[model samples]
Target: MTSSHRKGSTEGTNRVRDGGAVHVSPLELDITWGGDGRYWRIDQDRRIAELIQVCWLEVNGSVEMHHLQPNTRYKLEFKIRLKPDAFGWNDSPVYIMAMPGKGTKCIWASADLSKIRKGEQTCSIPSRLEFTTPSSSVADDKMSFGLFEIWKGRWKGGLVIEEVVISKV
Candidate 1:
């Protein structure tokens, strides 16, 4: 008999293998910053890179969607935390984009970044993109998703991104 680990395997997907999902690190993503690149800094702590000093207050990243299992459900989870000095995320919602099959879907998520108590406690924010793979095939075969909302011309800063996870549901 085949081992359980070998059953129900995601053979054709790059995001999964041996019943395990792929976790994308934030540092690996394409993060846009202000002119001097000084607007953002990759803070290394215990080998963990936290995208901090994000004055741009934005995250634009993409991955190949065609590698997902067709007709299956998945969740695009963004793992992030707010620093003590974080600002400008209160009145607006973070935006995400994805293409499960044939069409593109946009999602908006909100969090209380201002209320996070520094030193006393740490808060984690999860921005999820829940979608179902299309039997017809994913359009463009690529998915672009991130955190950013245009409210004004001013710049905002101080959020930490741990990683981005693509999990089967």
Candidate 2:
């Protein structure tokens, strides 16, 4: 795993055992107020982003389609953990949005974090947002994706983001 920052933006890449996976650290994501210490606590040493509290939630990222194996299927997931005292998730629904590449139709899927128990034990299970890549590479190289809970306008807290993984299915 390796991570770097460019112009205040974070980018990370990690190789999984399958040799076709990319692990994107939380710091690499375009998080709303991610750089602000008041709303997010970024621990460079641990390579994790912990959300202190926020009303407008948005965590976005992208990767070059070329980096992935051609004609392959993949699933995108966020590795996260909720503190025992986490709150404001009772009614709000978070959605995962993805666009395989430019000019492609965007897709959305709900990630039900509501039923997940808050604790260290449940952290091992990742919050999944499934999307398959295009069967072949397209003219546009970038595939944009994100996690959002903005519609509810609810203040949520105690969410810790480890990384987002893109792996072959």
Candidate 3:
């Protein structure tokens, strides 16, 4: 993957668009939603759950940050949800991995996603989050990090995700 580092602004920020193909920030890794099973959504039980068709595609991108002080960790959080009236996470953690110096495989560092307790159909909560990025000391070549939907150790249930954020650890 390629990266473009910009001057200033170490704090991770987001830019929102209305429609069409996505736009990427000059300094951030561009993660695209090409050919992921996410497009095939499961229908919610109409009698018990509210049928919500998400207008926004949600946050989509990569964790390849340029200008990161070599070895320093960058943490990211993605807030999500499953059902409208649902409250609780899948009891699973998010998995994060980094590839040092343009490697094909990602070195694993996990980001555990918390539960969804608060109500905010139009807002994001920290509980329902995928926590990634750690204060690391493995910087040698350009590093890249990201979280995965599936974790290795446990079984997952429920839904997680509402919004996303990126920052330094």
Candidate 4:
């Protein structure tokens, strides 16, 4: 069996490794209105965040490039699930975006949560918003990423964010 250790922390961001993949708990993300009990319910025991209600949905996270293997491709994704009574996602399109650092081009990938929900027959609603990490010229650059659905002005709820997983591709 293999075990991993906490690499260290920067501004409350603690990087943990599972093999070469980094698992970022929901508590590490910068979720809008996350501190409000009315909007979000954080379960520390489960290490997940559940959305009660929100008009603007913006969940963002970042990691230093040095934490990942250099010159290698990777996929960043959010491991999430939608409650059965989930609302406000039919027309609103959520996007998963990523950028290596400042002044770099941001890559976007449309996340179809509804499609995933419809296709699954089981009670499990686990889904992912995945994006390919853009290569950076500087090895020490910080990579910023997020799942956004703020443009439509829709009120959404029933989102359960498990964590952000970044793994080599």
Q: How accurate locally, in lDDT, is each candidate? A: 0.54, 0.74, 0.36, 0.71
Q: Indicate the worst ten consecutive residues by lDDT in candidate 3.
A: 47-56
Q: In model 1, where do residues sit more than 4 Å from their true spots?
A: 1-18, 43-56, 101-103, 107-112, 115-127, 136-140
Candidate 3, residue 57: the lDDT equals 24
Tell me the spans in candidate 4 whose CA falls farther than 4 Å from its real position.
Answer: 1-13, 118-140
Superposition-based RMSD of candidate 4 using all C-alpha atoms, in angstroms: 7.6
What is the overall TM-score of model 4 with all chains considered together?
Answer: 0.79
Q: Candidate 4 — which pairs collide?
A: none
**Model 4 per-residue lDDT tens digits across residues 1-169:** 3222111124555465777788777877777777777888878788788888888888888887667765566777777777788888888778888775666678787766676573213332233433444455576677788888899898888888877878776
Write the residue-wise lDDT of candidate 2 on 36-103 in tens digits.
Answer: 77788888789788888899888888877876776567778778889898888888878887787776
- Estimate, for each residue in 56-141, the C-alpha lDDT of model 3 and write its tens digit: 22222443334343444444444444554442234544554445345345555443335445344433334222232334433433
What value of lDDT does candidate 1 attain over all alpha carbons?
0.54
TM-scores, each model vs. reference:
0.67, 0.84, 0.37, 0.79
Rank the candidate models, highest TM-score first.
2, 4, 1, 3
Q: For each candidate, how many residue pairs have backbone atoms clashing (under 3 Å)?
A: 0, 0, 10, 0
Candidate topping lDDT? 2
